[model samples]
Target chain A: AQSVTQPDIHITVSEGASLELRCNYSYGATPYLFWYVQSPGQGLQLLLKYFSGDTLVQGIKGFEAEFKRSQSSFNLRKPSVHWSDAAEYFCAVGGGGFGNEKLTFGTGTRLTIIP
Target chain B: EAGVAQSPRYKIIEKRQSVAFWCNPISGHATLYWYQQILGQGPKLLIQFQNNGVVDDSQLPKDRFSAERLKGVDSTLKIQPAKLEDSAVYLCASSRAGGQADTQYFGPGTRLTVL
Candidate 1:
């Protein structure tokens, strides 16, 4: 089965500082990767997705992620984070087959933006 | 466009009680999904439907959980004789189609607390 791993359970970053969240996946084939963010008491919002084409993908809210096939990683990055960026982030992997294309997500990383 | 809609922003129930959640997907979406998110973990898909038909329910706890999308536009998820471990956030999502690359848009989840 395809699985995602996010090593960091919690990450604290100062406002205006750069941010990076690590994500790794285990899949036999080329996997479709996604990053999602969830504020407290809210449902998830897609940050970005990588299916094919360039390894780097830009998403809404000034976020980006790079899919590194050799490392089995799809890490999310932000050049500068704002206080509003504090949220729980999830990494997910998909692309198995037609009916089996549901996503498998990592545990997630809770981001805390310090002033 | 308007995002997915889920009802009963929060629900509290005791063990062995029954509870249900309602979801209305974005207009024109053909795929609906139900996910359960335990505290500190990412959302895990429980069931998926495509145009009023079940596409996947392999991860759903069929013994106690049931879900349906009758008209292919709205969906309902029910838990009978809920257990303590059932305390989690139930999220509903929809996509244009049940394909490998389709992006699923989420709704504000229904938080369930099983006492």
Candidate 2:
């Protein structure tokens, strides 16, 4: 079984400040990790994903995540965040094919942007 | 490309009532997923489908929950005798099938509130 853990339950950051959300995963083989964001009433949007090569991966809306195999972590980072960035963020892991893959998601971290 | 689509954006019902959610995946996507997101928790996978066939439903409470994908393109999830604990956002997601690079795209989700 695969699982994801997000240490922070809630995070608050001032507008224009840098942001980082921690994520750790437990999987036997090489894992595929992803970051997703959800607005108040909208579905989740993919922030980024890491499958193979290049530990650092970039995503939409000025977000990036680095996959650290040694640490078993894939943390999301942004140089600056906008008020719109305030939302619930989730970390997920899967270890199979597209049609056959099963995902295990973290409990999620609620992000608040202080204006 | 159009994103995943879900119906009845919101639903309010009393305990023991029944409710159903519908989802339309992307045009060529061969995999579909159903998830539940509580108020402060991350989305949990309830079921996964591969072209009209179920791949996983281990986490689903079969006693009250049922889902089906008739043609592999669209899916429906039903909850019979809903409970207050069933109040959450039901989300539908889709991805291209075959290999490990299945990046899921989520729908806006249907918010179900049990009174």
Candidate 3:
């Protein structure tokens, strides 16, 4: 079974401040990680994904995540968060294929930005 | 390209009532997925379809929940005699089904509220 853990349930940050959302996972094999964002009344939008390349990968909307194999973590980070960036973020883990392509998602972290 | 599309952005129903939601995946996407997301929890995979065939339905409640992608393009999920626990956001997502790690595009999701 695969699972993702997001330690932060809710986080508040001021505009222009750096932000980091922690995500840890438990998987037997090399995990494929992803970050997704969901606004209040919208569906999730893909932020980035890590398969089997560089440890760090850049994503849309000025977001990036580093896959730390040893720590079983793929935390999303941004140099600064804009007001529009505030949304619920989720981290997910899955296998490449081999009849195990379904994804297991985290509880998600709700981000709030203040002026 | 247009993203995944789901109908009935919001629905309110009484307990034990029946409800159904529809989804249309991105063009050329062969893999479609349905997920259930509670208010404060992450989205849980309920079913997965690979071009009109069922790939996985382990988490879906077979007794009350049923879904079908008859044409492998548009899909529908139905809940008969719905329960209070079933009140949540139903998300539809699709991927290219490349036999490898692929990003799943999501729909706006249908919010179901059972009274």
Candidate 4:
């Protein structure tokens, strides 16, 4: 079964500071990875996705994630975090088949930005 | 274009009561999904539909939970005899099924509380 793991439960960073959120996955084959963000009382928004080609994939909101197959990791990063970036972040894996289109998500990482 | 639409942003009911949530996917989306998210956890796939057909429902509890996407446009999720542990956020998502890459758009979730 495909699964994802997020080590950080919560993280705090000052405005304009660099940020990184860790994610790891377990799957037999190459996994399709994704990162999503959710604000309070809102639906999750896609941040980035990794399919095959590039190891590093850029996303909206100045965010990016690197898919490291060796370590089974797909960590999200931002050069600087804005106050508006405070939200919950999730990592997910897909790519089994049509019946397996459902993503396997990791426990989310709650991000808090400090002024 | 409007994103996925979900009704009843919040719901509170006593244990053993029945409740239903609705979702309208983005126009032309062939695939729809329902997920359950517990507090501080990632969303779990409850069911998946592709053009009104059940693509996958392995995780859904058939005894008390049921869902359908009639005519391949809108969908509904129902839970009978809800348990206290079922108090969580129910999320809906949509995507273009049969694509090489599975990209899903999410809807604002329905927060459920069982007292």
Residue A103 shift from truth in candidate 1, angstroms = 0.5
Per-residue lDDT for A1-115 in model 2, tens only?
8899999999999999999999999999999999999888899998999999999999999999999999999999999999999999999998865456777889999999999
The residue-by-residue lDDT of candidate 3 on B55-109, one tens digit each, is 8999999999999999889999999989999999999999997354777899999
- What residue pairs are clashing in model 3? none
Model 2, global lDDT: 0.92
Candidate with best DockQ: 1
Q: Which residue pairs in model 4 clash with each other?
A: none
User: Which residues of candidate 3, in runs, are more than 4 Å off?
Assistant: none
Write one digit per residue (lDDT tens) for candidate 4, span A33-114.
9999999999999999998999999999999999999999999999999999999999999876755676999999999999
**Candidate 1 local lDDT, A3-26, one digit each (tens):** 999999999999999999999999
Give the alpha carbon lDDT tens digit for every residue of A1-115 in model 3.
8899999999999999999999999999999899999999899999999989799999999999999999999999999999999899999998846554888999999999999
Candidate 2's error at B72, in angstroms? 1.7
Kindly report the fnat of each predicted structure, to 2 decimals: 0.87, 0.80, 0.70, 0.67
- State candidate 2's TM-score: 0.95
Q: Give the worst 10-residue stretch by lDDT in candidate 1 chain A.
A: A94-103
The two-chain DockQ for each candidate, comma-separated, is 0.84, 0.71, 0.72, 0.70
Q: What is the DockQ of candidate 3?
A: 0.72
Q: Which stretches of model 4 miss by more than 4 angstroms?
A: B98-100
